[model samples]
Target chain A: MSAAPELNPAIEVAGLRKRYGVGDTAVDALKGVDLTVQPGEVIGLIGPSGSGKSTLLKCLGAVTEPSDGRIRLSGETVYDGGWHDLDPRALRRDRIGFVFQAPYLIPFLDVTDNVALPLLLAGRSNREARQRARELLAALDVQHRAQAAIAQLSGGEQQRVAIARALANQPPIILADEPTAPLDSERALAVVRILNRMAQQYRTAIIVVTHDEKIIPTFRRLYHIRDGRTYEEAGAGRDLG
Target chain B: MISLAGRDILHSWGKYAFTGLGLGLLIGVTLSMAGIYRGMVDDGKALLANSGADLWVVQRDTLGPYAEPSSLRDDVYRGLLGLPGVAHAANVTYLTMQARQGKREARVMVVGIQPGEPGEPRYLIAGRQIERTHYEAVADASAGFQLGQRVRIRRHDYTVVGLTRRMVSASGDPMVFIPLRDAQEAQFLKDNDAIVNERARVRANPALNRPGAPGLAETVSRSQESSRMVNAVLVQVAPGWSAAEVAETIRRWKRLQTYTVPQMEEILIAKLIATSARQIAVFLLILAVVSAAIVSFIIYTMTLGKLREIAVLKLIGARNRTIAGMILQEALGLGLIGFLVGKTVATLWAPYFPKYVLLEPGDAARGFAAVMLICALASTLAIRTALRVDPATAMGG
Candidate 1:
């Protein structure tokens, strides 16, 4: 029900600029970045350190405002001349999902509750939210561990649960900042494989920010960022094992 | 919404419980301090109530019987008995001294009470009241005296024939009631050597040793050796008469210091125990400050420890109110646990204290409210810290 329109681009950004501080001391973190992603696509944003990948992700996630940009998410203008007529907190809650290097699942909550938290926060009934979470766990192949505490899960299973959490609210865009950074090669590839399958199945666009070499070739498209700008590249789209 | 605070507490219950236990001991000390003050006030009231008097008559210009020294002729009660509206009046003496039983001694208020009169203790728990004129005594149960125990006061050893409960002085020393003649002797008795020296001084006087006054010196010596003074006269008014009227008549006509029951209660509680009450008050304030500081430090440390998680929750769209609420709820939870443990601990240890510890329900309710309020205020620092955590912190550089 929260999916984007069938034909429109899932995310749109043009001349997006972000600056830290103000007046003479202000330093630009993101400048003139343009990107677009249609529904049901998973792309990579790869660069060396200090390339404004995080800054751009912060802008896209609505956590930080862009100084100069025309941004749209799920066919709605989120940041234009200024902020759009929508609450940023609600936008992040209902429209955007984030996956960091660590799974970052709340340790106090069990896996099912962790995945179900987003829905609960959006005012869904407990039974309905948990039911949806179990469905997602089954799809991610962690259904057996749904009732377990987060500490009891393996690294791969925790990441899977984290992805399920991100998908709970059915956000059209999931900005993954190095979701596989702490994993071995096999686990990293498996995470990418899971992301691609989720994107196709749910018609969600995912932007994975990574410096990992093992999963880089799996993206059909890659946005190589340097000096706060992006240069798109085609990937091998190799068959996942 | 899910109760984030509840989940967190359940996850780390041991940490919460142990911390609460430590805080509970502090709260227990605080409550016990308050109980001590109440006990002092209660002791003063008990001293007044156990005397079975409607009015107190002492020497003029003195705080009679409990707070200050006073003395009057032992025969003053006869004049008081003849006064209009006076039902009964009897002489009573109060002397705080150490009573010895062989090797054991305890501080006691030795009260010289007239038998079958207004000064007798109201009820007895063991044995009979004083029947002898010289040496029978009734002891408070708290004095650790048994029936038929020989209690030595000054040079004379008396038999404890009766026991009473809750009969204490304004200063919390247990009461030991004896007959009036024995108490007067104890108050005015001198050593035989001093008596002999006094007798020699009296007989050596030329006017007294003259033939016409041959026996006068001996009579004077005997009179000097005997004492007929009492500290206060306890008066009971007739059923149809007002004690205040009788007290006023005594004060104006007889020229004596007289106080009605309520006025005497005020003197004993307000004047006698004022300093101890203030001391306990100072202790209570210090304990409150210490409890607040400990709670604040604990909550602040807990908030700091979970900064990362807070940042993640913020980035995931948890509101500022939600995060702050979690911290506040946790602080209150700690206070509730602490109060429960403290109340139980205070009750369990109250009897072991040397002084009577009176834990009133009203004071306990007020203490519970104060603790909850302190906890709520203590959580503010942690709440502020949590709110300042930037949502962007969850997105690492």
Candidate 2:
């Protein structure tokens, strides 16, 4: 097997645009947005409601098609004008990881399977997938709850498992949308600390889209999105310890 | 790959089992309806087989002996016995009425057969065939009669001498074989009050009670009270002769309607119980449709409940077929559980039915296939819903 290419930026987007409908009734959700995140970096994307944070997250996650854009993940172009790869589903499965506002752990699956699902979907053997999931859970400090049901976990524990699931495939980048919105100040900051630790440990680039102001100071870099456009800025970069 | 549907079912087994049980009862009723129809057909065949006859000779232009009423002279069997290729022939009478033993009563087919004749029950499970011509009777075990038990026909009481199995008519009424003379009297005899009223009316009428004819009133009254008619003559063909040929011979010379075994079977199954079978078929169809609807509604609701989960799964790159397969498998699993429960319950309760319920294995296999097919078809609605789920929904607006 070939080793992964040494890429500086885990995800790069240039001039991304997304529009709903057509003609007079159309609304542009994302307009020529440009952003990039390097490996081993945790950045924050903060915006008010209806300011295209979701639209950007969806475009970056490879779920919704961007009307026009160039998107590269781990030094490979995934979308240029239209998807360069025909199977966006496979691209998403192999390349992208997602963390949602709620834990959104599959209720029927136990923690291990929920975390292992991405690897399984990637056609890994069950044992290998489970081994990888356990490793992630251990790193996330939720290994003790690996066999527990999603319903049996606290909100913080559920979010931690969700993080483990997002890291299951060892993706180069993760898109987190409002992941800390449901957490308290301490737990939200704790989640940010975990995210930073995971990013450094796995060399992953994570973009957290949030309205939560509690964890904003922890990001070394932040992007402020307004009216479908983003402006990059340096953050307080406060110590999480 | 992990089985999402299996895990879901295992996690909520209690809910799925309860739902399966409810569906199972409906399926059980549907299977029983099919069994009832089969039983009717089997009863007809058994009736023909137990009669030990190759041809049935009834009144001309009638579908008789079982499907319709036909009256032939009591001496018709002697003429049938003399025909070429004739082995043995006997007079038989059949009347469906309430047979009572004290206060307990059952609807039974009263069969009148000569001792050691063609129409006698083929085998006895208990006791012996009727030895006396007057009041001895042989009863089918399904009639709930015991040997030596006294059963009352219309006017006289008779003792059950034998018990037989599967000796039932096309309608599933158990047979109670009595002597020809007794059955004739019971079938034709009128009540004493009605007899007296008829005699008085006849005497007052000059046309019936002529003063010039002294013995006319007595003759008229004797003729009114006597019955020398038999329902049909059961004939056995010789070993070398074809039943159709013998039936044709009888129809030509005897001037009576003759039916070979197959023809008789057609009449009993196709004509006698046709309406009842159609009714049962309609019921089975309705139950199948209802089962499909219930399965569809349940799967659709379950899929709707998992909308967010489905969205997440899709966003995480689970293929559309994978999601659809999960829903389809769940529906099939539900159907399998329901079918097992249904078959068990149907078998357990079949004997308690008033008529025989025949649950043939072939029918069960077909039923299983049908249930699976229905479940698969029913899951399509849920699968479509799951597929339509937007993965972007998981990103949240």
Candidate 3:
């Protein structure tokens, strides 16, 4: 496994395992899960409650260490049995982005700043970061709300701004956890459409963790996790474009 | 990077303003307490300065006319003036009592001094000094006395002939100057009934009414009715003589407790008001602790309320230091506003207090630094909580 060539997969995992506690109290949250995502691809990860969907997302996001796994991003091994010599915070800032169930836009920041935050954390000049944020906001069709406060935006607009923020750093991978849990069918489909467009335009791989039945049919490929194990399947491939 | 603390404060400025206002009032009271202590010390110094005395000759082994009771013969100034360095010496008495004017009564320190003496008030802001020794008085302006107004002291009514400013006692009581003879009579005069009873008791004693000593009873009665005791002797040193040198000569030769101006100041400030100073210090310490506790509670609660947002920030790659800095900055901002408000209110209300309140710039500067330090210390609790937020918690596992 150590001699494997760098295939440049946006995100890849094999035999990822996460166990809580030790001895009799030990419980496995993820049991030898394997996954792969190609560039410019948007994949759906769906599962029932307590089925380790979030556990897998957490492992891939580099927010938590896996007990045993081989993980790679952009041809670099991030976790091989144990985490490599990389700052996890820098990994999240420069190589990965996250979207939550709620837009979770920083309440105090306007649209532009909320989008520019990741770039700022990555040591970009304020002007350059804000300029990059503006360009992304324009691409997301939310340029008109660049200076609007988070509370001023409608639910769908807030979600679009959140997507812009996730794509701000140009990360190779984005982990969106239930990105449309609060939206109706129309807004939910619109969010999925935006995510797909952003992934393709930016050449980024995105994994969307969701329980929304309405948007399940849109993905070309899907991963279903049951009891800490993943089963891959082909989706309905609905034409969302 | 955009200032997360500034944005958060601006977002909920109303909450911060109200909280700061409450804390500011507490700070205001703390400052005022400190001001009162300073005022007391200044009053003690002023009293010593206005007396225009180089040395104070008090009774042997006594603290003095201010801190303790000290009685000397009224003729003690005669012997003190005979000393080599003594330019002029005057007997003086001090008694704290109530002065009644019409329907109001004011607490005043009655000072007995002879006309043209070192113990007289240095300057008068209004009217003339007392010319008629028996029924004339000079009062401090704080006593609310008007010229020619009759004020009752003891069993006699004396007209206020002059008003002086800042002529206060060590305890901040306004000084009222009267003739030494009148003050002596007032101090020792007994009620008519008591005097009559004393006379009968004396006549009834066979030893005192001895047939061989006919005029002895009359002489003893006359002596008992007269008061010749004074509290202290105020002395002025001649040119080319240091007050310390003169005071030391009096202490050694006259067998009396003598104090130079600086030594008297020490007695007045360090000894007289030491307890009060300690009390204010304790109050300031308690207020500081309370302010810190309040700031900690508020910052901790505010941070706890943002736990979810903090998780999201951490997950999005915000460093621990950055998050902690945000919380710390908010606490400091609150403290700044509170200090400004507290200083303003304390200045505005200082003059209305009964005792003088001296708000010194040095004290204010020290207070501001203390407030900042307290705020910084208080923010640590909130910062610690924010730092402990696990980024993985954002995944809801």
Best by DockQ: 2
Measured against the true chain A, the candidates' chain A TM-scores are 0.95, 0.95, 0.96
lDDT of 1 by residue, A1-241 (tens): 1124466799999999988999999888887899988888899999988899999999999899889978988678889978788778888889989898998889889999999998988889999999999999999999999889989999989999989999999999999999999999989998998998899898889999999999988888889998888889967667774
Weakest 10 consecutive residues of candidate 2 chain A by summed lDDT: A1-10
Q: What would the per-residue lDDT of candidate 2 be over residues B1-397, giving only the tens digit for each residue?
A: 9999999999889989999999898889889999999999999999999999999999998999998899998999988899999999999999999999989999999999999989999999999999997999999999998999999999889999999998898888999999998888888778899889888877888988887998888789878877899999999999999999988898889889999999999999999999999999998999999999999999999999999999999988998999999999999999999999999999999999989899999999999999999999999999999999999877764
What tens digits encode model 3's per-residue C-alpha lDDT throughout B1-397?
8899999999899999998898899889989999999999888888888898999999998989899999999988998999999999999999999999999999999999998998899999999998886989999999998998999999999999999998888888899999999988877777788788878877778888899989777677777878999999999999999998999899888999998888888998899899999988999999999999999999999999888888878888898889999999999999998999899999999988878899999999999999889999999999998999988877675
Q: List where candidate 3 sits over 4 angstroms from the true fold.
A: A1-7
Model 3, residue B104: displacement in angstroms?
Answer: 0.7
Count: clashes, candidate 3: 0
Candidate 3 similarity to native, TM-score: 0.96
lDDT tens string, model 1, B35-150?
98898888878878888899999989999878899999989999989999999999999999999998999999999988999879889999999988989999999999999889
Among incorrect, acceptable, medium and high, the docking class of model 3 is: medium
Using DockQ, rank the candidates from best to worst: 2, 1, 3
Compute each candidate's TM-score over C-alphas.
Answer: 0.96, 0.96, 0.96
Best by lDDT: 2
Each candidate's DockQ: 0.69, 0.78, 0.69
Q: List the residue pairs that clash in candidate 3.
A: none
